[model samples]
Target: MSQKKPSKCKKKQTDEISLSKKRNTRAGNMGIGYETAADFAKRGANVIIACRNKDRAEAACEKIKKETHNQDIHYKLVDLSSFASVRKLAEEINQTEDHLDILVNNAGVYNVGNQLTEDGQQLLIQTNHYSPFLLTNLLLDLMKKSKSRIVNVSSLAGMAAKMDLEKLNKYNNFFTDYALSKLCNIMFTIELASRLKGTSVTTYSVHPGTVKTEIIRDSGLVAIVSRSIIRTLFKNATEGAQTSIYCAVENDLEPFSGEHFEDCHMVERYKSAQDVWIAKSVWAKSENVVQLR
Candidate 1:
């Protein structure tokens, strides 16, 4: 693929929120991911919603098709905790789609416990960071076929995370693991942008603010007991999806490719996210973890 001139994304532009039949936008998860996909579908994009559950994916597709009055939405199954599953999803997309215009790595977990995936990695890390990293790498060729934007849904929790390259695959407490995974998402975006510099792909990390979603359903009693308060304080799925949707469809974002965004605007990246050395080191470690050749 030939490289396209990087847009002078110095000044952020308003949201376009439209996609043609030639552009394909894929988002993961069900909550904000669903909202993001629906918004794209409303604008006439070919949308694919990827997730682990067959029932949920099917239902989400059906609902989105009805709500958007756009029948182009579809679903595919993907277990983010498994490398095999991630690869399979990527393979299927690459084989079936002519080109990919946007990829939203929106699915993630929190406080999922100390268990490991079949891939022998911490469940949280695998689901939140490693699998997305591998999937992006696997789909790069297809994405490069068109001008593409890669959005990894990160979190504000990443601001509190301290980078420890060795602890990436090791599980500590739930909170610690979750923070680390989010930090890794930012690092992954930074490194991926550097690697894809002259290419047609631009990547970003986004914080969808605190949203009312099942992401916290595994946080045990505190989450259960605080559900009402959480709902009262957090943004709804559509509101929370603004930044991810912004990064995906907004124009002139190529110059800020590796930057972090929140509230639909580019904000200062966390101190840790600015560490290029650490970002490179994290990428190397992640490649080994995912066995990316």
Candidate 2:
């Protein structure tokens, strides 16, 4: 006699329940940020989904909640382009959580035409570099308290950057602004790691393999021409998030503070990025910027 097959309804319910635990296990460009949060939540982490849009953040939280069956997932509004918003969010996090386990400096902007922040810094530089620097500093005490890990998502584009104190604003070149911002990320990660040595906190910077995302859409002509090629050539967002997730959760990484990573392995940074003088100068400049607040 043939055995009875499981009911389709039962199969569907099981699938949904499994997904509710860990959704989107595969690589995809758009949902990786949420996927990373979901994975962390499944591992019993309480995550804060920081984003510029309240609606989008809430929607992302809901999706993670439904997918992971984890109510600890929540959202916070933060516009990295604005220092005030970053401070506000940091204050709120400090007040609410006794500890922050992981701080991922993942949100970034690029290819946007010349734009400036209220502080008069270039928008990409402000968002990608300065604001994260400021926010991390403000939250350092809490991170130290929790012995949290800090991960900065830098870029391969940073290799092309040349530290130009005079042209940091890149008044004539938007691409330089973007590249320099990423370089700043790496430098900040290294310096912070050095400062936090012997402490529970550690810092790392990663070059997330090129992934097709909305960042390119900001560049009209180039985006139109490159979209298809990028889609075909680049890893999806989940793949991009891999090193970030690895850095956030892996035990082996804690001892290797200040290291730069790509595809889950340590790699040397650009010569300029590794310059002690450049790092010191950038750190001083960053301190001044945050002190103004």
Candidate 3:
């Protein structure tokens, strides 16, 4: 007997179903994290909102679910300031999820004064840089399995910051530390994209604009005054989340892999952010900081 041929329409439907099984994760609770999660949920994707506080995480998850009418949302506790906590969170995620379709490193801290994580790394650097690096490395296998996309929420501040790799951990000023951390984000994206060259996992860094987020929450009167003044010019968290969402789900970004994006458009970045030598140095030092090697 002659064998029946496969239907092209059936194959197309199967492909669509597999592509739509996108599992998304974002760090941070309020601000762009909440909005990003909601945006993904609205598109029929399962999301994981990883935050430092479980209660807030749960609340954000509920709020996102309610707003999007998508029930596939979950929350997990992750404290980027502590290496142990980051490891625990990554371990738990890897154990339960067979694949991680999208990861957005959206959480960041901008603090004044001298503060350090348990790893003896600067608080700003650890939260904004090292922790994300470690988490990405740990989840790389899962991301690879899913042929995923990684969106890192960086900033235009990175364009102006000058990084001194020698004294990177000796940070006290908020602006410099914040900018440096973001620069690191772009550099890491560049390096990771190179490393995953043959793999399906691709990475992109985003400049979410000068959005009104909780980054300055703990910075005293200065934080309040800045927020009030910038409130007039800067976009809100939902508006700021646009570029991140664009990078995460844009279907035709093959020619722009490892690029920095702003306002949902891919553009050239700063000289420092584009330096290959600097990117490699940051990658190697970050490995030592996180003991990845």
Give the winner by lDDT.
1
| lDDT by residue (tens digit), candidate 1, 1-293 | 13343332222232354553446888854788988888888778889888989988898888988888989888888998889999999999989998999999999888777888999999889999999999999999999988999999999999989999878778788888899999999999999999999999999999988889888775468788667787789888888888888888776678888988888777878986888999999999999989998
Pairs with steric clashes in candidate 2: 20-67, 28-237, 29-237
lDDT of each: 0.85, 0.74, 0.82
Supply candidate 2's per-residue lDDT for 54.
73
In angstroms, how far off is 50's CA in candidate 3? Answer: 0.7
lDDT of 2 by residue, 127-235 (tens): 8888889888888888777557888989998899888777766565667878888899998988898889888889899887888767776547767877888888987
Tens digits of per-residue lDDT for model 3, 27-70: 45799888888778877788888888888988888888888888
lDDT: worst 10-residue window of model 3: 6-15
Provide backbone clash counts, one per model: 0, 3, 0
Q: Kindly report which residue pairs in candidate 3 clash with one another.
A: none
Models 1 onward score TM values of 0.92, 0.87, 0.91
Q: What is the C-alpha RMSD of each candidate to the true structure, in Å?
A: 4.1, 9.7, 7.7
Model 3 has an lDDT value of 0.82
TM-score, structure 1 vs. true: 0.92
Better of 1 and 3 by TM-score: 1
**Which whole-number lDDT from 0 to 100 does residue 147 have in model 1?**
90
Off by over 4 Å in 3: 1-19, 219-221
